[model samples]
Target: MTTRARNVISAAIVAGLLLPAAPALAQSDEQQRIRKLEAEVSALQRRVFPGGDGRYFEPEIGGTSQGTTVTAGTPSTTALTDILARLDAMEASLQTLTGQVEVNANTLQGLTTRMAALEQSGAAPTLASAPTPTPTPAASSPSQASTTTANNLTAMTGGASSQPARPAPAASGPSSQRLAAVQAIAKPKTDDAGDDEYSYGFRLWDAGYYPEAQQQLTLFVEQYPDHWRATYGRNLLGRAYLDDGKAREAAPWFLNNYQADRNAARSPDSLLYLAESMIALRDTDRACIALAEFGETYPAVAAGRLQSQYEANRAKVTCTN
Candidate 1:
């Protein structure tokens, strides 16, 4: 054969072989793409429906007219829309929760601020004076007599009596002498000085030296907070203020003593006194609440010496049943 003729025939044979291979390569590429798409869809299905009972797209929407042939790279638009809607709903819910948290934080902040003010001032603001209610003289317990006298004194002082801002009745010679003796008595030097210190304050209170008793008991409680007598001292401190005609200033101390330990030795007494202070402040509602709490919390104690005191105070106000 001639060279040009042989070259032409060789080129034709090569063309035939290459053309067949081109179709085979195209078919293989298409199969690889389909397999990749199927793998991606399987992963998405596993993630969206881990239990495998549910799939992202409905079976009716599969890309087959005659059989269950699923088309590669095709997803249900409605499923995508539902997922987006769910995401939007979750965002809205998160925003609502965040707003509630902020509101709670603000409320907590307000409470903290009020507590700080109460601590700094050592009392709440004095309320306006109202007509002081008097307890009838039916129950003549010694405790009741003493408390009635105190109420009369408070009403007189708060209404129009020419008392100083703080009462200092220790000016009389007998009171002065008693106070001097009390001052001379040294605090007991022992691991437990609580008893002696509390007794000293009690003596001052009994002797009508309320200011001195307040100072002494305040120091005692601060020094011996864990001591058994601290409860007594704290309650007595409030009583000193109450007897001094400063019921508003005394109420917080009484409340603190009762709330510090409701089962403590003097906690029941403190609750009674807290109610008394409330009555003096003309807050009959809170006074009744304090009285109710006392009766409920210490039923046994309320039936004892406190019965007369409770009845006397209960007579002072009309509480709702």
Candidate 2:
């Protein structure tokens, strides 16, 4: 009935009405935020999985999709193990293939070298017996002996007529002396027999006894396979054979020396001799190849100590380059 009581009652009634409607406004705002979030998630799914079949969350336990069930069992663990095993197997196979590739590359390189040799050998000359060494004067004709006697008589007269010239010494005298000198060389008996034997062989070869030189050098090489002088022995053996008119047999030895160790001291010598042997065998094509290889491989040696020999062999054959 009073104004103050009436105002208090009106304020209570207004508070009660606003308090009931506040919860409904809050609920409406919450629903709008959830819808906005759902729209944003849908847009993200479209960008991430254009196929439109992707799940935003993992499948529920024991749920089935594509006929395979998600479960608490060990199926996933087994699949992971299988994938790791496959990866390891693939790695091992890759290593094996890599090793095989290396082997193939080496084989290919060897084949290429052989092919090049074959190509160069296409027009090679046929092998022939090496020419024999020239005979000494003991086998001279009667006319030659008469000429020699006249030359001796003229030397004794000193350009004036003289009393009858004395008969010349027997031809056997010089031959016997040479034989005795060669026989006196004797095999080496010292501790450094390899060096001694090589020296012996060299002397024999220089003295024109190629068979004896070949024998000594062969023994030297066989007995001292690892000796430093082995390269020299091998090369000398080839030369002895070549000098003996056995070019067919000599060529392989020279080639072996060059191929065995290209860095050996006697390697260049062997190559030059190999070319010589090939030329002696009438295989001028291979001879040229060997000479070319010598120039390319040992330019310094080809231009130095072996220059004369190299040029002489090159002149025997016609090379393209």
Candidate 3:
């Protein structure tokens, strides 16, 4: 009885000891597996996230994370879509800007070509380099004080007027009115040697500026009745009217010029323009009369070329009378 009881008691104690060891061993294995998994996850984050800010975690605070961490490996399709949309918008803007740049380039090229053509055509002389003039002598007995004053002025200027350019008087475009004003001031002065009526007018209306030319020419003719260049002035006036798209106004002007200077070389030219205007007005009979008159008056002139052209054109014109 004693031996049997002793063996049973030993067996029971050993079983109890084995049961406690099994639980502890299992806990140790679980802890080791968790450490290995943690290390692997840290290595993966360093490779994939780059300082924990690849659209995910940010820097760590003292004890706990500041913002809620989104679960890793979840595809943020919304953020990627937003980035693609912004890129598309930028591309579209770039295309529009490129189109505008091309249009501007074409406009600039056209402007440059036109400017070059205008420059090549002879224009008014540039005012940049004025000629140096010789000094003028004063009357005899010119005192030293007077000479000094003159020299001082000469030193101040290179013998040119430094007076402020008189502001051009305002006008509502150069019309007959402006011509009238100048004619009033310059009429009796026409006989004066210093009078520069014709030249003044020419300067104002130069470069084929027809309307301005006509206004200046009118002033010159109004001021001087039988002056040497009076007929020349009238001829220019007619040509100016033609350039200004005033054919009817120009017709009488040419006739007046031709009548005033019958022997002038410009007589045939004035007659030709007059005929052209008459034809434009549908007065073919008068135009032919003018043409015949020009042919008889000046048979050999540069303007005679216009007469032949007119005859050829008349062949096609429908005559009213």
Which candidate number has the best lDDT? 1
lDDT of 2 by residue, 1-321 (tens): 999999999999999999989988997786667667655655664565354442332222332333333333234455467668989999999999999999999999997777545323211111122323332222124422344432432232124332112123345544777779889776555556667777678777767877677777787777886776777778878878878897866766676666566676677787788788778878766776677767877788778667877888898888887
lDDT (Cα, tens digit) per residue for candidate 3, span 111-196: 77765443222121222223223223222224312444323322321233422111233466556866575455422233342125
User: For candidate 2, what is the lDDT?
Assistant: 0.65
- Clash pairs (backbone) in predicted model 2: none
TM-score of model 2 (CA atoms): 0.44
**Predicted candidate 1 versus true structure: per-residue lDDT over 12-63, tens digit per residue:** 9999889889877997787667667766777776677554544464322243
TM-score of 1: 0.44
Q: Give the Å shift of residue 18 in candidate 2.
A: 99
Q: On a 0 to 1 TM-score scale, where does candidate 3 land against the true structure?
A: 0.36
Q: TM-score each candidate.
A: 0.44, 0.44, 0.36
Q: List runs of model 1 lying over 4 Å from the truth.
A: 1-191
Residue 296 in model 3: shift from native, Å?
2.1
